[model samples]
Target: MNNNLHIITADTVREILDQYPLELYEIIKNSYILHDQQGSINAPSSFLFFPHRPESRIIALPAAIKPNQEKFNEISGIKWIASYPNNKLKHMPRASAIIILNHPDTGFPMVCMEGSLISATRTALSGIVGAEYLYNKDKSCKSLGLVGNGFIAKHIVKYLFLLGWKIENIHLYDKFSSSVEDFRQYIQSFGDLKITIHDSVSTLIESCSLIAFTTTEKIPYLNDHNLFKHKPCILHISLRDISPDIILDSINVVDDSEHILAANTSVHLAYERNKKDASFITATIGQVVQQKQTIPKNKTIVYSPMGLGILDLSVSQFVYDKVKKQDLKNIENFFPS
Candidate 1:
């Protein structure tokens, strides 16, 4: 057995990603294309719900990608992630995770790394990739709206800046005032982007051309289709925030139909409401990215990405490759020989 396993800490992952931000859009783009080409195996994530605290749950995602023309190395990994919405009261992050990568040929564990940053970054990049194809790039969207002011929302804003989206205003709405204020202070470091705190979701929805939902709602909440005045491109990052009627009224896109439809998400609710019909989902993001489906221009485009494990593997592999070239310390004796 090869004794070359490396343990990557959360601080290391954070430092590497912060220092050398890769072209995540492209990395995620290739991953989606690989997914569309049937070059990847992604098992549906297994969820362990807390009986005492019903809103909190842990999820295990396992996936592998076969080597193809675009990517030469075979990669297989799994991410164990947990989300506790009430963790914010204790001033801790809501989500915590770890990813494990194994040698594709030998099945020996090769790398184990912190995965919360990977999770957030990959999820944010997914939103940006979807927005790239679905939103009208020719038209200038000055205002962006964020429905939740949390860790995932912060990463999404970071990626939006990295992608060079010209936003003149940011409208933020959060249940907690402190969360909104903290997020506001964080974004101020980037530039003098106008940031407004909205009193209600309806106001924020009406104010921005691009809206992202990053809350921890397990059930449907945002249902009013009439509030969307701009035919906004909605990034449904948190899957279950928007109601079924809103889904039916829009042009819906998802990362994977099967995965997103399984967890009582807005799409799943819509499917159940319509008597097990899936016509509400217009196309997968891969199909849109590959130009297999025509992007509609006149309707609200809702993108719901189920947070695939392939993305976690891709980013983890990239970080591992980059970190190997650096002078960083890793856990040498993660396992006994």
Candidate 2:
């Protein structure tokens, strides 16, 4: 197998991931634990912004998870992903990506797999894990609000069900009415859930106990602190959606404080507004997951995950391992020496 490497396609990646939804959650959870324990080298993502089209960007995330004697072998990889918000208007996906994994022992590239699915799946899992840790799971969430009706929102809904969240109501709001309608119909197929489409963001925000913002907004738009009542759980998945005032008023949590603070995210903005003080960032998800930090329940909780590269590595490695076991026939030779 020295001369051969596998080139996994998007369809295969989706198939494998769909087959083991719970396993994907566990993989992401363990990866977060490993990340908290400092078992991984997570480099900051490099951004390539378009000057002409300022909304579009391509990011390079390089990461490596240290070897574990019992669980995972040493692995290093990079995910090169691009985001073009206008692609939706052109009737295409907003993001596309590929991951290249290097051999641990020899530093030779061993796998090249389609990474968009991995990216979405891992991201969705991260949000769910944050909710699992930060949200009051014992208390039932009757209404779920999705601020953006996009691919990431859809995946979040999918994994929420996979994780057995008994959400009876789903409130969806999008700038585009067509996207909201499509999302409403898609979630309706799941059955036993009430779906409502809202024309305004504030209306949707007020309707749900668990709210998720998955839009492409680069700056803070939701600034009103009083809009958040009843100590709801906010999944700040899109990073920059919430204003710093809201972040300051809420109990803040993050995937990584340092990484998330660098990208001008809502958390980053909060840091900036507060004279670069980081006391507002209460704890990382790893700390919460490990029970090292306790998130107070009296205030609204905002989880801002910067979308770690280590997570991409974990999910990509999982896909590679699964493909090797079940679909050997699809393997391709990268260097046929």
Record all residue pairs in model 2 with backbone atoms less than 3 Å apart, i.e. clashing.
none
Worst 10 residues of 1 by lDDT: 16-25
Superposition error at 54 for model 2 (Å): 0.5
> Residue-wise lDDT of candidate 2 within 195-265, one digit each (tens)?
88888999888888899889999888887877887778999999988888989888999998899888789
Q: Tens-digit lDDT track for model 1 on 109-204?
A: 888899999999999988888877888555346888999999999998887776677778989999999999999999998898789999999999
Model 1: runs farther than 4 Å from truth?
138-140, 327-337
Stretches of candidate 2 exceeding 4 Å from the true structure: 328-337
Candidate 1's TM-score reads 0.95
Error of 2 at 57 (Å): 0.4
- Give Cα distance to truth, residue 8, candidate 1, Å: 0.9
